[model samples]
Target chain A: MDFLTILNNSAAEILSPSTAAFALATIGLNVHFGYSGLLNFGQAAFMAVGAYAFAIFTMQVDPTATLGWPMWLSFVVAVLVAIVAAVAFALVLGIPTLRLRGDYLAIVTIAAAEIIRFTVRTSDYSAVTGGSQGLRGQDYKGDITGLNPLTGTTYGFGPWTGTAYDTWIRILAWTLVVVALILVWLLMRSPWGRVIKGIREDEDAVRSLGKNVYSYKMQALVLGGVLGGLAGIMYVLPRAVQPDNFATAMTFYIWTALLLGGAATVFGPLLGSILFWVLLAFTGGMLSGLQQIGAFGDMSGTQAGQLRFVLVGVALMLLVIFRPQGILGNKKELSFHV
Target chain B: MSETTTDGTAPTATHPLVDGEVAPGCKKVDPIVVADGVIRQFGGLTAVDVEHVEIPRGAITALIGPNGAGKTTFFNLLTGFDRPNKGSWSFEGQSLAHVPSHKVARRGMVRTFQLTKSLGRLTVLQNMLLGARDQRGESFFAALVRPLWRAQEQSNTEKADSLLARFKLDTKREDYAASLSGGQRKLLEMARALMSDPTLVMLDEPMAGVNPALTQSLLDHVKGLKDDGMTVLFVEHDMHMVRHISDWVIVMAEGRIVAEGPPETIMQNQAVVDAYLGAHHDTDLGTLTNQQVAQIHEAAEEEVPVGLEASATETTTTDAPAEPGATAHDEEGKR
Candidate 1:
């Protein structure tokens, strides 16, 4: 077995740009479910809107199919459009569902995410969205790669080496994560943050104090959604824009990362995302090596691939059963009304 | 005391309802809160059904009744915590029928929950800070920029600190509310209510789970509210407390007002006595054995004298019932 390669791959996954993207998304989840006690299961929908909006704005396509905007302007426009789309999505979902408590929001949000995924996959909008095949990396990779200051350099030693373009994306993604963390830290310490925490504990108590509970919840939803949109943009930076990437499972994975670290804590998502990806990569490598060596009598390569997720599921269940507060969350802070 | 005012306004006469009076719908001379046809129901059960009731302005009014008498429900409806089936109530002069609980508090009428709704996860100081009115820091944009609300926050903290000292909870300022004792939580709730500077403070069972040591202090703090020219309306089951501090008493039974009078007379009223002992009224004395009869007599003798003394002292004194009560009234009158 190539144990050395496995270790290197796992290390790379931990520091990869995708890990940064997931960390940012989970941070937004922390704001929604952790601090505010809002049950938002459609984080994937926000990410999808952000990714698609950014891709569409920046892509050079037929005049009828796309905007064909300038690359730099498109980058700014894409981010703005993604945030606005997320807010619009929050309004459409939040206005009606925020009034209802708990499971209603969960059901509506999960359903909304599925709807977004399916809508993008349909042939009806294939002209702009590229349908099921989705827009490939070639569409906007040149523009994104062109912005990298390090034109022809390679970083890191041995197996850890990354192209200048990859390095640029990683820097940008991690920088976004840092910015999101600082903003969230400032927010949670403020009076507004206290109100959100109060709502999570007991909304009625907050209402009795003359603070508008609904308005606070809506603000939390929009803030979290905007962050999710940014995460979506970060996610697409290193790869192609695929509708499948924004599926319901993507949200669950983000939730898993959030819960794995610590739901309400600032550092929880960052650590959780890194650990999750690293574990997945390490397990995948070990399992594939074992299968190639005929470790299993009848289990095929595909079965081994599926078994890796099963192991992850088991790990998640154990985590919930024993340490429900997650790695960094305080047991006291986790006593939410939901 | 019964002399009518010549100013063409409602009479400010004391004890409008005579001793042992059973008024179906009592009206105050200058009512601070007026309710008409207020009814609340939970499925088939009618929780509160007040046809007409007026709470006297600037007086300590006690709403007393047996269990399930709907005292808390009435408080809920008046404070806009719960909606009434069909009713309208006004605070000061504005109608509060459709006003929300937060707006009711903003309009100078605040209430505490019977179960004590202190934000448990928050610090005592933070809880007190939350009670401050119209905080700029509470806004979304203002919260991000501390300078916008830093001065207001400092002032609010000062106010909260003073209130905490007044409530004797200054030592536990940084402690989480959940870590506090039951009685301390009650104190925290009352102290928090004062941060609003409310005109009318409605306390729901402020002494429900409190120890005797804290109960006396809570009683004094409530009396202090009246001394500061704030109208105090409280829901209480402790007859001794109701008799000791209440200027006027309104008693409810089976979701309707059965008696209204000064504290001294409310105990002697037939409607109230029946409301309390009505379940045993139909019991046959002949059916009970001699031992059981003696036990019943012993129980009555022990309880009846305290009630009698409470009523007697309350009715005879035109100034105030107890020494503390007298001083409280004087202080209020001075204010």
Candidate 2:
């Protein structure tokens, strides 16, 4: 309940693998909503596909499991499978919805994400998907941890300290985030980016210019979703792969992070994700410390735990009102649209 | 043939534009685009029902009509922006019916929107660059490696720069297209369309919101397209612009082609005079007498006004009314 301990806990969230995962996912959402003007409200579905495909496929390498694939082969195939699944999801979602107006995509994506959650949680596919309780992290984390190069009990210094496994996961998660950032940066400056941005402004105009607007949009959707899938894998790396984790609220949280950082900007997602988690952790720590000291007059830990999100909601509203274009977005470019 | 272009070239389509008698659905000496039975209906309203239309290659053909005449809808159908009830169209002799707008453009036919659809958030240069065809950098995988597309990007930038310079938009290249004036945006849109070196150009109301002086420059640019041997088809309410720049004019009324001919004779066409154009179609709005103005208003009360129905037909060098004596000089100078 010490204030120093509270501050330390909040700071630790900045470098947490969870922060990296959300950052990666928000970057994917940025590609969807920010650059392409696509409203993908089912980003969590893309993440879910990644997590499930990776966990299920990697689990196949277990000697007792079916197929009994080699560990190395399973590792490579799991990543590839995640990517392919994300693409298939994109094609399915985009073929019918991309031609429609922007709002339709938003509706379809949100519905699709929910459908994915429900379908996976249903008892019918419980053996493969692990049902509502979901697959345990220990089942599949072994491959990634097996591949980890770090060989120390503990790592890092001071407030950023973590076990070697934690350090390895952070490295893996951030490396993916950096790669995605670089890819997005390169794309936005190219003629491909110009065409995409033009579609954002007006598809008719881009179409008149002879660029395949639909193809470009599909490409963006798949690329962003693949990144989302990777983020999904990252999200569950340090914990369990619960079906409830990829619920509608997860998609909304990614959106909040994207808007907070700047939807169209290169570093906006990373910044937004860091700020969102750090603030959430900080507020949660403060509230619980107060609760332990009887500040809420016998407020239960569960009740205090939920209060931090209320503060986050308030912060998000304030952020939207004051800086809707986000920290890094150009006011002239995205202020009206964002 | 002696008509000097802005860049000192002669007009390419000087021999003859039509194969026979000038009429609705008339055969062109060389048509870049040919359409038949393009019927588009909006529930109770028939938007466009052009039975046959041919756009002359390497010449500026003006498509003019009053409000609700379906000129834009026909433009949409031909450019593959809208679907027709039943129609067959060919661009450069290849059938293009049901082709998407981008494919229609890829066939070397590009269009500009009547509302001037400039990508507002994009820089003026970026807007122009988006019009370039076969851009290697525009492919998703190719975009990642700068080396793969750097040479093409450089060449494209150069081409874009020259087009911007030609449109007099070079100064605003780095500025976002949204920040441009209405006239500048029109100019930018036209320049962007030219980036692909299209064989056919379709413009919808390029002069609707432009200033008159800019209209004059836009007139020169359209003329320049013919000099470069690119076919130009445009929708314009500005009778003056249509008469000055267009080599041929096609008039539409109530979703059908009413008449087609050179603009000099279009005014004298009996069918055009009755079905659509006002008697004072050629008269400058600034020069209209109070009685003539009242007649236009009176006509509006009865039905759609022949001349006054056009929005901003008088956008010119000055909003100040022209002196009575200047009208003759203005008409003569345009001729």
Candidate 3:
């Protein structure tokens, strides 16, 4: 029932690596749904691929994995593997479906992401994926923490404080977010962005103009999926590569983050992710605190936890109803349709 | 009738467009696009089934057909947007069969859609710039480096600015295209197509949904294409537009080229008049009284198909599409 602790924890989420990871995923989704108008409903699948690939490479899942590689080599190769796998997945999903329409891609992507989650969680792959148990955070933590150049044990001021290792991950994650922001901004500002946006509004128009709508859509899918893979890598850096964490709901959370901020803007994802995490933490903390103080009557801790999602549903409806273009979207230009 | 409806801006011979006798699938003196055995089907419906058609070079040719004669489908096939069942088309003598739409555009043939596809979210300038071909910045990796595409982008922007001004859309350059009226959207779509600098520009019903006030300017813009030494092919329902600007006219009915000749000849051809245009084409549908409509309907009852009656009725009264509506209204008045 400690309000101070709840407030402090909620504030701490603003700079957390998880928030950064969510921002990264939202940024990638922005590239897909916001700019290219590709409705990718399976962003969680990309995160799964990146997380599992990076972890499996680091853990040396079996003897057949890249043998005798150093930790840094494993990490780098793991990232590359994530990127390649994401691109491959994008191609698999895009080649047949991108030509169909936005909804078809959404359907295929959601199915593909769910398949990835189920396959990884199945007992058949328990030897490598750890099944429902998931790999321990300690196993992957060593590689990244060992590479941390910062010597001091504790870092940052006030409630923003973290261990040297945590600070290192946060720094790296935020750096990626910044780099992704710049990349999106640069691309969107260029003539390439003009074509991508054109495809978003009308692919046929872009096609008639001779810009290869299919190719542009594929590129956008691959580009966004690669970023999603990178986000996955960063997401699991501090946590276990849990299969359950990358459920369909994970993809939706990323979408919520994207829409909450503004899908097509440069810093909208970052701002949204931070705000989402902060508000989520605040709401969850407040609900749990209220439950503990008997405000919920006989409601259990789990039921109290479920109430925050109801709030999310309400928030999403309000967002769509009031500001479909989102916080940073231009009211005149970027209104949501479908 | 004049041999060429082309205005006094420049002098060009009219009959120089056709090579042989005026007929369906006739040869052009210099054909920019030649299609052989182009066929497209959707279930039982053969949308486009052209045997042999040649688009004349450096001239404005109008493709005129009734509603379902597959004019847009033919345009789609030629532009490589949609594939034909078993035909080959060459744009500027380069075989464009199975080529992707963008490549078809790169090979110097570009098109516009029947329904204006102006990128509503983009500014007018952005929509125009997207039409330019072979930009270094359009590539994904090269776009990251501003220096690689900045000069080209600048020049493309300038080109786009000029086109917008020419289309009288310069004032709306900074505005989102969604804010534009229906006519402006059509103009923007055409201007955007011109950005590619194509040798052959195919405009699919460029006048559809356009305001009549802007139609003349749009007509001038299409003429301007021929003036710039580019071949202009357009699909339009307006016969006046076809007769006023087109050097040649290719008539399609039931997915086949029914006739091809100078605009003057196509207008005179008996089969062309019967298949489309109709015998009463000179009589304004709107001006016809109910008695006049009934008289025309009774006289042409055996010749005109039920489809043409619906279309004729559709033209006369926008809301009441059938004689049943007129009869029902008469019953209401009697009651």
Interface RMSDs of the predictions, in order, are 2.4, 1.7, 1.9
Q: What is candidate 2's lDDT per residue for B1-335, written digit by digit as tens?
A: 23312221122222267776567888989888898998999998998989999988888899998899999999898888889999898988999999998889998989998998989988898988888889888888899889998998889999999988888889998998888889998889989999999899888998997887787888898899899989899999899998899888898988999888777667666667766756576656567789998998887787755455333344442243374544654566689
Residue-pair clashes, model 1? 0
Top TM-score model: 3
Off by over 4 Å in 2: A60-70, A334-338, B1-15, B277-335
Model 3, C-alpha of A25: deviation from truth (Å)? 0.7
TM of chain B, each: 0.79, 0.78, 0.79
lDDT of 2 by residue, A109-156 (tens): 999999999988999998888899899999897767878899989999
What's the lDDT for residue A136 in model 3? Answer: 85
What DockQ class does candidate 1 belong to? acceptable
lDDT of 1 by residue, B1-335 (tens): 23322221123323543222226565666789989999999999999999988888889999999999999889888887789999998998899998988888888888888888888778899888888899877888788888888898899899999999999999999977887899998999889888989999998998899999888999999999999999999999998889788887899999999877777656766778899999578667667789998998999999999999976765665455457776665568679
TM-score of 1: 0.84
Model 1 chain B: ten consecutive residues of lowest lDDT: B1-10
Instruction: Name model 3 segments beyond 4 Å from true.
Output: A61-70, A334-338, B1-14, B277-335
lDDT of 3 by residue, B1-335 (tens): 35544332122323566675556887888888899999999988999999999998888999998889999899988888888889998887889999988888888888888888888888888889999989999999999999999899899989999989999999999988888898998999889888888899888888888888999998999999899999999999998899899988888998999877677656666668867767576766567689998988797876668778867775675455366776666567679
